[model samples]
Target: MPTYQCFDDLQLFFKENNIHPNIRFENMNENSIFSMVKHNLGISIIPEMIIPKGLESIKVIPLELEQTRTIGLAIRTPISPAVKKFTEIAENWCRFDKNIV
Candidate 1:
């Protein structure tokens, strides 16, 4: 997987779990990793939002883990209606994102 803080964390996970992948690739752009998987270059582990299309991959697997990242939206108290609406939409998108995985 391309190097990132998350990859460091994943390395720790693999070490702790005693799992290893024989072949790996590293790059700054996540799309590079995705492209590897998409073009039969390699397999990758990544978040769902990076996917270019829905239900288009050869296989899709979901993981139910003991932990998940928490997401939130914050606004100053006297926010305009438009901002509030935007936050609502964003919050809903967050929920949808979580459910898909």
Candidate 2:
């Protein structure tokens, strides 16, 4: 897993489930984790959106626990029309099913 903020969350999940992972590798990013898993190094938990859908060498499994990451849009005050529209669209997009968000 990443040695960043996300690792804290993953650690929390592990603790909650009383899981003691014998972590053998650490990486800074998802692509490296994917590469490691692809090479049969070990399994990793990553955001579902990142898994390449067509990768036949790997299997994707859904976790029973639902996890979410916060996302944001940064715009200065006095927002332009385009920014306002984009924020509106983004808000609506997030309100939909995950498949469409």
Candidate 3:
């Protein structure tokens, strides 16, 4: 998998599951791991946000652990009224989806 850094969680999963594969850790920022998987180098566990278009070739195997990340909106002071309204609308739109925070 094209990983930016050594993932301890992944290592632990491998140890617990007895999975040993040829591993090559590259600079994480160089490219997304999905790109490496597309090149047929190896497989990886990645967040869903980075998955590219046309994902039919890639098989996404779900992990048992509850992996979650928090996201927030940042606004500079003296924000325009329209911008503030848009932010509130966006937050409501996101909240409409019960699965998303």
User: Best candidate, lDDT-wise?
Assistant: 2
Summarize candidate 1's per-residue lDDT along 67-96 as a digit string, tens digits: 244455678989999999999888777768
User: Cα deviation in Å at residue 37, candidate 1?
Assistant: 1.3
Scored against the true structure, residue 24 in model 2 reaches a CA lDDT of 85
Which stretches of candidate 3 lie above 4 Å from their native place? 1-23, 29-32, 85-93, 96-98
Could you say which candidate leads in TM-score?
2
* Residue 75, model 2, lDDT: 89
TM-score to true structure, per model:
0.63, 0.71, 0.57
The candidate 2 region of ten consecutive residues with least summed lDDT is: 92-101
Q: Between 1 and 3, whose TM-score is larger?
A: 1
lDDT of 3 by residue, 43-73 (tens): 7776665666678877877777656556678
| Cα lDDT listed for each candidate | 0.66, 0.80, 0.69
Assess the local accuracy of residue 97 in candidate 2 as a C-alpha lDDT between 0 and 100.
43
RMSD of each: 3.4, 2.9, 4.5
Residue pairs in collision within model 2:
none
| lDDT, residue 10, model 1 | 66
- lDDT, candidate 3, equals 0.69
* Best of the two (1, 3) by lDDT: 3
